[model samples]
Target: MLENLLPPLNDHNLPYPDTIHPIVVHFVIAMVLFAVFCDGVGYFSRNSKLYEVSWWNLFFATISIFVAVMFGQIEAGLALAYPASESTLNLHTILGWSLSGIIAAITAWRYVLRLRDPKTLPIGFIVVGVVLTVLVCFQVYLGDELVWVYGLHTVPVVEALKEGVL
Candidate 1:
């Protein structure tokens, strides 16, 4: 199926060309994409099916994001073994956890509202999804600052340095 064809996470931690990091990055990007799509559907159609799908997407996305965050932490912990930058890593961790919590709350609200009358879905979806999008955007901006500006993740580089592979 088209769904199964999506790239998977790089659990093996291999040094080869391909890894799970890109997959995880895409996964987070997917959340933003889904949010946009769901919001559009809910806003334009106001259809129960669209509302249902949006809530389900948000619920699954929240769980997946938490998993990706754990992977980030593991990568950070490994980086800490050497001369890794602590400030950016700490910021990344804090922002990631905070965003995860917010997403979880939004997911809960979506589902709880979905269980009620279909009319209730739009108001909750608009309010919660809007709030979540703003928060997520802020978190993502912080993440970009951590990586591109500060270079928090030195794990792969450090490993390469140790092995003299580069």
Candidate 2:
């Protein structure tokens, strides 16, 4: 039934069209970075506006990360990843899931803080943001490795997989 309803899979093995994970992941990344930026600037500048912006960004990021992860899980399953890329793919998958939960918890914490005082942010929140940023950077590196170094679903790689070229 699903096979009949779905369109032809692309070279990347996607049903509808081009890879959607990367596109959605970009939004998540931008939101996370910008939220951290707003938190930092809001803290230093004593600007409540930046805090509000940060809150919204984090809130949206929390929602967007789930979307990103959902598509990532789908696309990863279709990637036909070879043995060489398996370890990295596994790690990326773990990190992706972890980030989703972390973002949700952090957003909940931010909501509490916002409700308490929009004008001031705790140093602890800023510290946690730094940790989150590092994790994001590492995840991005792993994702880049998958696409560039491993070429998980690129044309040549997919062709190689089909031809048993590794």
Candidate 3:
């Protein structure tokens, strides 16, 4: 009965065949990297204006990461995993959640710093941003492995699933 109300699952076996996770996650990734970049430039150039840009980027990223994680959890759960991809998928899922937490924590820290002194951002905080940037790069690699290497939810994989070959 509920099936009657819902749209048919598409090629990816999702109500919408296209994955929302990637679309949203890319934004999160971009915002995070850009925030870090802005912070780094602000630090090196001693440009207070870039700190404002960095703060806004981090603020938006904190909100967007949650959305990305929500879609990621849903899509990951729906993804068909073969033996080879299973472990990688598990790692990706764990790291995705970890990244979300890290982003939120960093944002909170930055918020505190902003409230304490808006005129200057500490070098220590900039270093932390660098660390966050590294983690984000690693996460991007894992996500790429899932989509590019493992082809999760791609056309061929979906076809194989339909044929009970995977």
Q: How does each model score on lDDT?
A: 0.62, 0.91, 0.88
Better-scoring candidate (TM-score), 1 or 3: 3
Give the worst 10-residue stretch by lDDT in candidate 2.
Answer: 8-17
lDDT of candidate 1 over 1-166, digit per residue (tens): 9748655323233333333433575576576558657766767776556665666667678878877787776665544222344665677678778877877877777667667764545554576666666766666776676556544444465456457654
Top candidate (lDDT): 2
Q: For candidate 3, give the lDDT of residue 56.
A: 91
- Flag the better candidate by TM-score, 2 or 3: 2
Q: What is the TM-score of each candidate against the true structure?
A: 0.68, 0.95, 0.95
Give the per-residue lDDT digits (tens) of candidate 3, residues 1-166. 9879978777886878599999988888988999999888888888888889888988898889899989988888878888899998999989999988999999999989999988788889988998998889999999999999998989899789779998
Question: How far off is residue 122 in model 1, in Å?
Answer: 4.3
**TM-score-better candidate, 1 vs 2:** 2
Task: Count backbone overlaps in model 2.
Answer: 0
Ranking by TM-score: 2, 3, 1
